[model samples]
Target: MAGAALPTAELTTSGRPILLPNEIECSLLSNVELEPEGSPPLSSSIHLRSSFLILTTHRLIFVSDSSAAAANTASYVPLASVTHIFLLKKSIKSMFGSPRLKVQLSVGSDGRVGGMGTRSIVATLVMRGKDDVEAFVDKFRQNWGARVWEREKESESASSGSSLVVESSASSSGFDSRGMRVVGVAGILRREQEMWESTDKSLQDAFQDLNALMSKAKEMVMLAEKMRLKLLSGPSQAGSSNDEELGSKEEMQDWLLSVGIVSPVTKESAGALYHQQLSRQLADFVKIPLERSGGMINLIDMYCLFNRARGTELISPEDLLRACSLWEKFDVPVMLRKFDSGVMIIQNKSHSDEEVFARIKLLITRPDALQMGVSAGDAAMTLGIAPAMAKEHLLTAESRGLLCRDISPDGFRFYINLFPEIRTDDIYLVKDQGIYATWIKCASSPSRLQ
Candidate 1:
């Protein structure tokens, strides 16, 4: 294939492809090779031996595990351009090694891979990894034959037509003509009662069957979003509502904030690239929550939040950990970190312990805290991290001579580092304006007040 005008697919920061509108990823296979039977240029760029193959509804995408290599070598073939898919020759040889899928594609007059042309070439998909080749082919064929893009186009046009007709009818039939004329308070109350009953009945009918609920899931998400917007627009009055009611509403709002992933990565859906795809999705999903939590969140908490966002497609703890670990391989903004005590956290790459230490310094040096010191939980609240993580940070800051820990009958606590500021040569000479001086003043002021 020569200048066939093949479009290069753009990838996310985490190396996942930017999916086209309505294009859902159907399957994936790693360690795949694209061998062109007739073209030599294919032997150069499209060869992509031992690459990761991703099958979408609209395109066949290949990516390299290495980010640098992928930038230069990654490419895709449009399903629309595929002329034919050859049946895999299953023999004794195929059972022993990797499986292969051969498909014919239309090329350009100059022999280039493209969407439309006269020339053609046969391309083979060699799955070097142990994968179910037959199932992949079935999915590929199903996606190709479905022509989902065309169906989506037709559905959009139909929806537009239907919406226009309904709007026109509603405009022509005003309140009086629509059988519900606004007369008085009693009439308004009756109309509102009728509307509520209609909505309740619709919800009852919608949830009657699994199939109906699945069909209405999108509508539910839109309705949740509308409610969330309304809540945000309303007046903020913390004392106006009871505590339990407010807590439940806040929890509901959190769920409605991120309704679902639309298409979550699953082992059945992504196959060999499940972890990779899930990693990218998790990276994108955690940005907002991580920012809200001050650039870090407990892994256990993230597990709950992530699964809630995934709805029915819940990932296991192992899957979440693996996905978080894969962030190191990609250029993801978030990274997984484990403390020496085995507590794990998901944090932004740019997040710094120095920043946490600075906040801790400010906290412990407070007028009240300087008298009694700060506990791990106190640091956690100020830093917006787990108590365990905050303790680890405090210990680290202690090691770095930024703080000092004291264990007493009262409790475990941390004080602003004054060991370095204290002069051993002159025990009674306290610095005038240093943290040491502040500590001396705080330590004596409480006695004076007593």
Candidate 2:
């Protein structure tokens, strides 16, 4: 249990594997077992049964099922350490019971797992779950044979040489005179212009097919992160820059952050647990946006923002709703809320409605707001929330006797509640300086002033 022939895998808060850079999930199976068939039980035999199995481009991951009686820690076998994946026996017994797969792993002299060594052990994966065993087997072979892990090394080499390649490509495409005094946003734009001009072929190839687009995914995220870092470092380094330039750099940094999700949970990868995993990812993604939007965001706006960050893996509106709904089952910091009017929004659970109400209370008491009142749009701008949601809050305030509504040529508006100040005994009777009198005075403003 302590030292197995496999490396311990790290999991996210929601118990999903934390993938390697550029790694992609290929398949998953629940309630599987990893058994070692040696003369005796091998010391590396994990003794883990009925666990979850995940196959990715780089590793075969095992997760403890939630219902298991033991501690839930994950373990993985890197395809880099896998020496062989034995052929399935396809016997009649296998067709009746659970299916099993055997893979040879490289181990150190002491029989401990390592990236590579001379000693080896055949790991038998027993599939006891309701998964497509054949599909799992097929993908396992494809991932093992493809050896995509090797591509990461090659990609690193290429990336190290990318600057030289980019310079050559730029020179070939006539990227202005090198002496052009480019700097700041203008400089970034100028560089992008040169890159686009020189990489027109890559742009065209990217959209040629879905496969081509998939290949460009990493580069896109890297570019976004790179720009984000540059923008982040710009202001500190910009001693002579104007306010407008610094502001533009900050805004550009936000956009770059929003545009990149290095790893998005996809339906193809998560399978039946797609919505659950997507919910966890969304919960994490929305925190910064929610903070920037004042602790809440319109569901529709988030849908657009989330999909934009997702790039080609766009989801349906229904999928978004389902993912939001799954947050109830997760311990994420955010929650989905639906107003009485059927508008949906996501807000931090710790966000206080009392603070929002306090803001609205102060807004309603403003001298101008007290005289003419404020519209839903006005409250929205003040509260940094959607107009529809702001209206809901205003209505709640009205119900609580904290505010009052008026509909007139000025459109529907909310004012601090003055109904309790009016004396019903005599309509003519008004307190000297009460809110009722103040309201009457404001209500009688000159038509020309109105």
User: In model 1, which runs have C-alpha deviations exceeding 4 angstroms?
Assistant: 1-5, 36-48, 67-73, 90-98, 104-122, 174-252, 326-331, 377-381, 384-389, 406-411, 423-426, 446-450
lDDT by residue (tens digit), candidate 2, 172-269: 55344586656567766888887777567766877789888888866656766777887888767779999888788878877776655656778776
> What TM-score would each prediction reach against the true structure?
0.77, 0.77
lDDT of each: 0.78, 0.79
User: RMSD to native for every prediction?
Assistant: 5.1, 6.5
lDDT of 1 by residue, 323-416 (tens): 9998887777889998777889999999998888778888988988888889999989887777877898888888888888899987899888
Judged by lDDT against the true structure, how good is candidate 1? 0.78
- Model 2 TM-score, 2 decimals: 0.77
Q: Which stretches of candidate 2 lie over 4 Å from their true place?
A: 1-6, 39-45, 67-73, 109-112, 116-118, 161-198, 216-257, 421-450
Q: Give the Cα error of residue 220 in candidate 2, in Å.
A: 5.7
